[model samples]
Target: MGLDWAYFRRPYEELHDRHDAAERQEYLVGRQPTAAAHLAELAPLRKREPIPASGYTGDDERLWQIMKLYALSRVSDYLIELFCPAGDPPPGFGVTGGRAVMEGSTTHRLELGGWQINATPGWIGSRRLELDELAAYTGFFTDIGLTPFEHAETFSPFHHEIFAVMQDPSATRVILEEVLWPGFWFGDLLFSRAGVRVRAPRHLIDAAVATTSTLYFTFSREPRPTSDLSHNWGSNSQWRTSFHRFYSDEDGLHLNWDGQVDIGEDPPQQPADQSDDPNPLDQRRELLLHRCFVRSALPRDEDDRFPYDDRLSLTTAEWPLRPESIVRVPWTR
Candidate 1:
């Protein structure tokens, strides 16, 4: 939700604010995205998709690259539509800015065309100044059978994206600190992990490290080169991709959307679907969870591995994680 859904810096008036409108009515009034042209553009993306087959492997990095590419393109659509019409974000474009809670406001730092534009704009009386109105435009997702999920009672790396964290030295486990932004679900497929602030032990989740702003949804939460989808496909099809639906309960982790793809058993460190490559899963689904949502909630090699330490190894049952792939834990659902 952080970088993937970057702040729409303009005033709320710039967005036809739909908070007061009904969900159905909002869809009726929002941008009428053309599907024929957009789908044609996204059809080629599947040729590079590596999920279910590369769920917990090295190729997962390539998957993250694709996800960031999708997010950047979507966020760029809002930026170009609202701010700089003449602007075109290059291939390596990334943003750095978020809520300044101390000031009770939000700001953005956009580097483009050899200049840095730091914008601290007013939210036009909206409660969430950081969120662009487009974040709420879920018509494409819902209309196609995908569900948008945001609220969670507890904290789980699988269900919530680590936007911000609190260090409690005496804390035994993660506590639900705050909800930053909503995530999405497609029946059992986790489209996007909900953005939330989590309270955890400093030993398990470092405060300074986790709070340090970079790009939250980018490849492995670190800098990496990715493509822009808007330059090719419209925003419509990118909203429909694929993700592994994993669920957590009092028992433990349940991979593949409570057994959607059925990776034989749980703890998908190795893919169990011995089916065909490229699809093994999506071919059997009615809706495709956007690859952007596949940003991977687990910790990966040299990527956000600091939040997890030997303490986590001792408590693997607490949160089944790997950092860059898809999975669930026994906490937030």
Candidate 2:
């Protein structure tokens, strides 16, 4: 037997009507406003019974796990959209789908949505070259409609800081202490991602900066499940099914970087087989997801009528200017 599961991102009012009309009517009569309020009212519905049963089949359990994981990932993406300044980014800017190819140590070619962004690493021990390349990449992103700031002036401080830090020999430590550490702390408080809480930011930063590399950030929407088996398994499977074609309103963001470190100059390494495992490196991307999600979820005091303020500024005050703060921070060596 195939396991089936469904999930919906519907309003609490809709869900309540389908599952328990009486209770929904009572809440509606009270004149409660806001989806959050309705959701709180319907919280009890979830505990009434397991969709299938308290004791689930093996297949049911497997599907449940997949759904839960997917849900958390969706939540993560939602938070990113909420906090990241680049609201509802274009098909490029790491959204949709893209590929990054390293043409040389300092140059990379990014292709997405029939557009291309050629990025030359900006901070590879050459101040002039780095600044020029940063300007070039900024223009490239702006042309593609992924402008990093609401106001062009906001870019000045960021550019200065990046250049200043890169020139200093203690750049790695400064970035960890001032940027990554604080950003991660702020993120942990918002997203409730326990995994990020236990790790040391110093170690993570050290690893990333240890090598001369080019980083590529990519975001893509998770494909919706199409199998019939995934659609028909539970008593309340209809409630679990996601009618929407996409996992999130936005794409799933992924961070990838490539570089080479001097084996002799750095600490001893594990054997080739052990070193080939991608989990440790992949965790870096997960850490970034947590950071962006929490930042995007940060509350803003703005006009209720205009919920989305594209002019909303994401500066050092609003969001810590960390390496992982933006949707994409491609550093070249």
Candidate 3:
């Protein structure tokens, strides 16, 4: 049987709605800062106009807008970290550096590293330089503001939770239509990594099932997992990445799965008496999802840079809620 979209759509939609209401309530009550004000303040720094979308052409304008909005949101987060007093650390995360201080009665300034610098100095001075540096590498600076520790424990997982929900179909639509698209369309432009969106909840489920099926079919051959030949066949980490391509037609979504099955070096010959012993160098398969999504169907020269070959492909027959079919194509040399 193929992928079942109906089975997962309901739960995903409910979770998405709950998330949206929670976010709205958070913003309304002043628990979360408004995105509009932040974007307006940083408007002058944007470098590009919004990429317009004519037909689908596999280039989704909304997806690009989502990326831009996400970037802006990160910048806003960094600014909060820079100027506001540090709040209580999230669970498993700790803060080391002292909280940021605001100075100057008439012209407020940001004080970090125990020294104060003019916050709104002219476009070409030290203040601009600081802002530029923060904008260019928002993630790095945000990490610095959070803690001096090198471990992942220093950062909060709140954004990740939101992202996980965003991948769901109901959540994806809500976010694309309500939250992200609005921010992208009406808000000031900013920098973004790419114009693609991946990990839509349904797409993710498809990728996982396809990957598992591939592994199962591959293992069920002459060299079965329970067979002695399986002993000689060592497995290495599996790299799995997914991306989405949009279409104007009925099949509006294409979820692509690229996976690499690493075949490790031959294991050392075991003593015939100890054949049942486990190989110390036995490798485990690890899956890595490359989160990047492209902006258009136009051929990119960098596509050749992908380390894995196209192993599995799946696409929906209808937009939004239909089940997806696994596309089978003949292998090429």
Q: Who wins the TM-score comparison? A: 1
Off by over 4 Å in 2: 1-5, 8-66, 85-119, 122-168, 171-333
1-333: candidate 2 lDDT, tens digit per residue: 222222212322242343333443343334323322422332222211213323235555534533432332233332222222222223322121111123444346643223555654222221111223233323322332221432122222212111111123333332311211111111101211111111123233222121112111111111210122123455444334321111101222111111121111123233444443222322222222222111111112100111110111111311133433333222221
Those runs of model 3 whose alpha carbons end farther than 4 Å from true positions after fitting are 1-310, 316-323
Model 1 poorest 10 in a row by lDDT: 305-314
The window of 10 residues in a row where model 3 has the poorest summed lDDT is 155-164
Candidate 1: how large is its RMSD? Answer: 14.9
Error of 3 at 131 (Å): 9.0
Please give the RMSD to the true structure for each candidate, in Å.
14.9, 19.0, 24.3
Tens digit of lDDT per residue, candidate 3, span 1-333? 222212212222232243333342332234113333433343322322212323123354334333333343333333322322223322322111121123334466533223565653211101101222233233332222211122122111101111111235543321221111101112112122111112434433221221111121111211101111122332321111011111112322112211221112133333344332231221111111122111111112211122232122224221222223434322222
Best of the two (2, 3) by TM-score:
2
Name the top lDDT candidate.
Answer: 1
lDDT of 1 by residue, 105-124 (tens): 34676332235445543211
Instruction: Give the runs in model 1 whose Cα sits over 4 Å from its true position.
Output: 1-129, 132-144, 212-317, 320-333
Q: What would the TM-scores of all predictions be?
A: 0.39, 0.25, 0.19
